[model samples]
Target: MSSKHKYLNDWAAYFDETGKVTRFAFRFFREAVKPPYEFRELLKQCYVIGYQSLFLVGLTGFIMGLVFDLQSRPTMIEFGAESFMPGMIGISIVREIGPVITALICAGKIGSSIGAELGSMKVTEQIDAMEVSGTNPFKYLVVTRIMAATLMLPILTIAADGIGLFGSYLIESYKGDVTFKLYINKVINILSFGDMVPSIIKTFFFGFAIGLIGCYKGYNSEKGTAGVGAAANVAVVIASLLVFVLDLIAVLISDIFYEL
Candidate 1:
């Protein structure tokens, strides 16, 4: 194909996919509200997507906090501002890094897992079997997962932020002589409700995006085992990208609301 023709084709395909995903998301909303309320399934998903993923998320958060502090130490010390480390690191992590990092980690773990699981079911006709048996697969499968992710991510982000701050405290204690109480006081002094609320709010969107992309990819998967692998890979990629995109939009919205 010619370059121009290929570009046009790709663009058209992109729009087509976007339309389909948008419609799929709408269907989720519609089915979500009119349900028999899959509370058990939702709780299971929360355990799987949130509680199960805590170790990895916490580990990543701790490392991120420690490394961020260490990396910024030289710069702060150069400017004779080493004492500002707690406030600076705390605010950054609480307001942005904590949520974004946690979301990205969940995208990789939870998103890929959902995609692979559902994709396998799709390939094996399990979803179809559910339909034939008069089960609302979309409700039992998609809605519960999406709702669990949406609710659990903010909780995970909160946990991550606390752990990350603790990691920073550990480093500070080792490097200097700061006590946990003093470090926490400094962090609290710098942070406010404004800093936290928006960060937490954005995480819900992150979770929803991750779950939505995973379910969409898996539910529409084709080509048997190969499609399952492809769905898992694509779900992670798209969910991670959506996290950044949603973060940007959240920042813009926060700025506007705060300014008002």
Candidate 2:
């Protein structure tokens, strides 16, 4: 095709894809509120998606805190602002790093997992069989997973923030001789309710985006096994990108609110 034609085709494809995704999201809302809730499956998904993900997310947060403190300490020490470390780390972790990092981790782990699983079921005709068996496959399979993710991610983000703070404290205690009591005091004193609320709100959006993207991609998967892998790969990429997008929007909204 000519360059002009190719460009137009690309834009057309993009718009078409966007429309499909929008419709899929609308369907989720429609089905989500209908009767015959999948409480048992939702609980199972929460346990699998949330409880199972804790160790990995916690470990990542711990490592992040240690490394962040280690890297930032020298700069603070040079500036004769070593005492501000706890407040700085606390604010950064609670306001930004904890939520973003935790969501990114889940995008890699949970996003791909949901995609691969649903894609496999699609290719294997398991989802079709469920429909044939008079089951609401979309409700049982998609809604539960998405709802579980929406519920669990905020809780996970809070957990990550706490663990990250603890890890930062360990580093501070060793290097700066800062005690836990003093660190906690500085953190509490410096941080306001505002610092935390934005992060908490953003995590819910992140979780929703992750689950929705994963399920959308997986549900529409075609071409059998190869498509399943593609769905999984695309879900991770899109979910990670959406996390950044959502985080940016959260920051912008917070700034607007702060100014008002």
Candidate 3:
């Protein structure tokens, strides 16, 4: 194919995929509100996607805080601003890095897992079987997973932020002599409702995007077993991209709120 033709074709395919995902998302909304609520399934997903993933997210957050503080310490010391470390680190983590990093990790772990699981079911005809058996597979599978992710990610982010700040505190205590009480007080003074609420709120969107992309890719898998791997890979790539896009949009919206 010619370069121009190939570019046009790719653009068209992208739009087509976008339209399908949009419709899929709408269908999720429709199915979610009506029905025998899948509370048990949702709780199961929360345990699988949220609680199970906590150790990874918390470990990442701790390392992030430690490294971030270690890297920033020299600069702060040079300017005789070491006392500002806790507050600065807290704000940076809580307002931006914490949620984004946690989401990206979840995107890699949870997104790929969902995609692979559902893709395998698709390839094996289990989803079709469910449909034939009059089970609302979309509701039982997709909606519950999406809702669990959406609700659980903010909680994970909160946990990550706390752990990350504690990591920073450990570093601060080792480097200089700052008590936990003082460090926390400094962080509390610097952090405002504006910094936290928007950050936490945006995480729901991140989780939703991750879950939606995973479900969409898996639910539409083709080419048998090979398609399962492809679905997982594509779900991670797209979900990671969506996290950044959503974060940018969230920042813009938060800026507007901050201005007022």
On lDDT, the candidate that comes out on top is: 3
Angstrom error of the Cα, residue 22, model 2: value is 0.8
lDDT of 1 by residue, 1-260 (tens): 99999999999999999999999999999999995989999999999998999999999989988998888888998999989999999999999999999999999999999999999999999999999999999999999999999999999999999999888888899996899999999999999999999999999999999999999999999999999999999999999999999999999999998999
Order of quality (lDDT): 3, 2, 1
lDDT (CA) per prediction: 0.95, 0.96, 0.96
**Stronger candidate by lDDT (1 vs 3):** 3
Superposed model 3: Cα runs more than 4 Å off: none
Clashing pairs in 3: none
CA lDDT of 74 in candidate 1? 88
Candidate 2 lDDT, 169-248, residue by residue in tens? 99999998988999999999999988988889999999999999999999999999999999999999999999999999
All candidates: TM-score: 0.98, 0.99, 0.99
Poorest 10 consecutive residues by lDDT, candidate 1:
65-74
User: Model 2: C-alpha RMSD to truth?
Assistant: 0.6
